[model samples]
Target: MNRRRFLQSSAALSLLTAADFAPWQAISAFARELDDFVRGPAVKDHPLRQVSKHVWMIFSPDGFPTPENQGMMCNITFVDTAEGLVVVDSGTSVQIGEMAIRQIRKAFNKPVIAIINTHYHGDHWLGNHAYVDAYGDSLPLYAHPGTIQAIQGVQGNMWRTLMEQWTNQATIGTRVVPPRLPLKNGDELKFGDVTLRMHHFGVVHTPYDLCVEVLEDGVTLIGDVAMDHRIANMDDGSYLGTFKAYDSLEKMGSRIWLPGHGEPGAGVLKWNRRLFEGIYQPCEQAIKDGLALEETKARVLKDPRVSSQARDTKGFETNIGKYVSLAYLEAEAAGF
Candidate 1:
């Protein structure tokens, strides 16, 4: 049996032979210790790698959570500004955030001054707990108003539960700590040597998805608006809105587009654009032709961009059909 269960069994046996009140007091103290042990061990530190002049990242190659990965499914980016280190997206859990903090201390040895939650997704922002713990409640945590609201409401606990389920309780002790400051599009914050500009295109990835441009580094931290090789979950996103966001992002003239899920590169937005078009355009055409959902799925699968990316893209085979259906439904609604 596990340590907690064994302790419980021993406690029960001692209770059967209780001749004194001291044993009961000891069991109560032991119960408090058991409560402290609910969460699994802290995640091992992942090495931090520099991505730009000011940005360093703890890159998690995996895109989905598993017991083995312990919910480290998103990239934790640290921008080293003269003021201090600014965390782009904290990570997936308190353990993951603590692990990232360990790496940050080893590499940069700077305190985290601020944290920006790109969207309301737990994988991107649930690690806020660790930063707040290390720094204090006074540390600035920024996000779009909608993101802050969602996390403050049901989305906060909902994601905490989901991550726990997905990671087989590996993330058991994480608590929801939503962003406090709300940032809108075109807002700029100066952090000593670094200047960050926030961009929000309505309902692209989510209604309040915030993309932060590190102006000095010529890189934009594109939250889930696009990804490198994996298709984004579009349950709250739009094909048309994503395209519009891409148009606006390209005009900003940032050279490197870093994503929350994959490696940073110039082609991050382009790669997602091509893949999204491959998934959505054919469905749009199918809707115009009065084609059924299955037929649209076939057309999307046969598209050159989709077929070529199928082998390399994570969740493409399993998620493409659902994406095609969403695209077809969107196209039909747009036609109305």
Candidate 2:
């Protein structure tokens, strides 16, 4: 069977199975477990540690993964300057955001003057309300035009979903907050001697993906655009576009990459681009061969490149299936 038929059949089978199984109950149970794990410990508030004279990073622990999967962790960074502090991405929950803020306060007496949201994802921007509630009108939030629309368009559904997946109803009732400011591309934010430049990388991870480059500090917070090749999520439109944007990042080198998840690394742009290419080439070949979706997914999963990454082998098949489905749609639209 070809790719299209396989997907159609698989989708039909999935729907039938879903109708018979109580997946929501399983999901609810897993969500509870995740909430317990995420809320188990509060990371001690540490003062801002300076990376450069003008740049300081407030490191906070990762947030719980969305209920969709396990082992994924989210992170946010804060850059401090003479004028005030500029947070890179607000965390998933208000408590996480507040904890990050407290750490910033421990290092610098200045208030948080600006927030740059890398994208519209709930994990990155949902904590904006926390800063707004604390600072009132003193804080200015920035994000790409597309990102702003995503946050406003969802009407907080994404936030609610994340809260439900990561935390229980009680926690959700307590800590969830909304975004305050909407930003555009090419917006330059100044804080004393430090200047944070925001640039939209067209449509990559999302239509509104933005990268923040600190000129003086030589650090780029490249949001989810730079993944660790561990089960890359392509549910968002433009998976290939993400590859192109990452290519641009590779050309525009930075000293260190502050990613939204995983450990901080150097030369992330190049590394991510290579990973994207590795995934893209095989999928493209499978498309050319007219393989069915399941065949393509199985082929991709068995490839040495897929196994090289530290991800569950079984999970790779599922991730590849998703990528193949989205990539097929993209290729079709482009008249491939």
Candidate 3:
């Protein structure tokens, strides 16, 4: 099922218990169980559901990585075009990426013409190894320039190293393959039957974040810019950039939206604004008054509009702290 139906269904979270996990434990659970997630069970082939005739999205469950849920905490989107296949954001590792590609081949005969990396996050692009190995490195991969530069530099290597340690040894041969194509904002192209319009906003979710629009189907493939139900990590995210991305999406007026994480829909953008604003006003005020990091975090946690959905069952040190810390840093840097 697509994100819309999956999230709307009462059983969407049947297996996951959304308790607060330590940042490392919740977000990097995949690294901890890399072996089990790759070789343990039927972890690879989750389910790939159709968003449109030309679009299919693999919706991951909502929660930090865990053995029970595996490391499929992020969604993968693949599109079928007239000429070939187009993929957006590979999975976290070689195994997960392989499973996604296997599922893609099961449905069509098209050779993948392009793979798009929405940002610099390893989970979104490290799966590039699988596609490169299968289709050959000549297969054109697309991403923002900053994303390409980061992956080709030491920053990418550090993220890769961290992934290997977190997944135990499961990430062993998963090379960090940078995208071959640098896509500019508003670049439009046609692949078979679908028409693609690219969108870029500076330093919202990351230095290089790209969203795509399928003009043919009124569908938008937005990366990590928008999230629903849960609080998104803002350590590298910008409070103002997030709102700018939302405004861009609103202008596009697409009925279908596939998020990098969380369930897909227009609602994702709507709630993103609410969450950021709730944290920003409180955090901004604290920073203006010369409150310390800990004090700012405390103020954000007390504001339920932002923290209520993301609060853990027993810990005051919630994922909300990640947002608070990031927002506070941005405020200080901007001289709020």
Q: Give the whole-model CA lDDT for all candidates, comma-separated.
A: 0.89, 0.63, 0.75
Report the C-alpha lDDT of model 3 over 8-123, residue by residue, as the tens digit.
Answer: 34232431344433354543454434423333233558778988878888887754444445456678898888899889988777777888888888888778888999888887
Residues 89-150, model 2: lDDT tens digits: 87665555677778776667888887888877777776676688789856777777666666
TM-score of 1: 0.90
Our tally of clashes for model 1 stands at 0
Each candidate's TM vs. the true structure?
Answer: 0.90, 0.76, 0.81
Ranking by lDDT: 1, 3, 2
Q: How accurate is candidate 3 locally (lDDT)?
A: 0.75
User: What RMSD does each model have against the real structure?
Assistant: 3.9, 11.6, 12.5
**lDDT tens per residue, model 1, 1-336:** 654457667775675568454666777775655544667668987888888899988998998898999998899888899889999999889999989888888887679999999999999998998899899999999999999999999999999989988988788668788999989999998999999999999989888899999999899999899998887999999999999999999998989998988888999999999999998899888988989999889889999988988899998878887888889998899889
Give residue 70's lDDT in candidate 1 (0 to 100): 98
Number of the top TM-score candidate: 1
Off by over 4 Å in 1: 1-36
**What is the Cα-based lDDT of residue 291 in candidate 3?**
93
Worst 10 residues of 1 by lDDT: 29-38
